[model samples]
Target: MHSFVYLASQSPRRSQLLEQIGIAHRLLVAQDHDPEPQDPEALEQVLPRESATDYVQRVTGLKLDAAIARLQRRGLEQAPILCSDTTVSLGRHILGKPESQEQAREMLQALSGKTHRVLTAVALQSGRKRLTSLSVSSVEFAVMDSAQIDAYVASGEPMGKAGAYGVQGRAAAYIARISGSYSGIMGLPVFETANVLRAAGFAI
Candidate 1:
């Protein structure tokens, strides 16, 4: 079994989640200080008429492919590589990370007093084999007035989060309930991740 795996995500929550499961991992992220860092956002653009399930899975696959190439280019030690992507959706509308505070508020407003699906797609590359899993959870938010929405947006917790909120952050106050894996909503589904890791020949 591999001693450790490479995580290709910049989210602290994902790293923390892996640590929580007693998994040792090294970051395989593209450094911001690079002379020409790749545009990360370009990989996340929602294609026309794409479903949330398809989008998250495709992005995760793409990210894993990039990480594999990155490892080869850097001549790093080979091991399993993991990548994940999360998306929030209400009905057919997909809500990604908010670009600005105003957009964050708008996303939050749309989610107020409503339940939405939080879908997290996880992909792992072990040698020539690839494995994938998806965790779908439902989050219900309490009705929020404009003042509450404004306050949450001002705190900036919603800026970089899907559906303009974080289940593990201050937004939990207004989260009426969650119907599925909390870890999945937070970014990485623990159960799914462990299963994928085991399939990748990593001792999880």
Candidate 2:
């Protein structure tokens, strides 16, 4: 197994996923950073006109670049650095993390009784080499009532989660079906992540 890698993400779920796979990773959170979406009234504004795959890949690359620069500055550039980003997409519109409980409710309502795609992009950087992988999962949600949405919103679990829901939390009760990696839905695609890590010299 690779001795250890740097993980540039703040999501506990992502960290847990890595631990579940027995991958030794050191957390490398961005300092005083905010991931708020850029100016726009709609989620699509934050995403480029490119296809979903391309959009995710590009963002992952950018994140990897930032992380790599940080590692280099710290003289820890020898260890592999992993960066990932996840987005919940309804058609061409990307539903990112909600900024408020009201926003979370709206996102959940839109996702009610519908099938949406969850795209997770993973990037691994080691020295001058960088590799990226994408995982897309189709998720179906049952129709949720306002009461359910309100209660979930009150629980405060949707605030920092993409799509205003977490598959590993209470939101799991609302998922009707999933056609791809559950770990991917939770913010990391274990299978693809492991593949990339192994390819980058990490012992699985």
lDDT of 2 by residue, 41-131 (tens): 3422364477767767777777777777676666764688898888899987788889888899999999999999999999998767777
TM-score of 2: 0.90
lDDT of 1 by residue, 1-204 (tens): 799999999999999999999999999988656422346788899999999999999999988888988888789998899999999999999999999998998998999999999999999999888999999999999999999999988888997788889999898999988999999999999999999999877676
Model 2: residues >4 Å from true position, as ranges? 33-48
**Cα shift from native, residue 170, model 1 (Å):** 1.1
Global lDDT of each model? Answer: 0.92, 0.84
**lDDT at residue 154 of model 2 (Cα atoms):** 94
Q: Per-residue error at 178 for model 1, in Å?
A: 0.8
By TM-score, the best candidate is 1
Candidate 2: C-alpha lDDT: 0.84
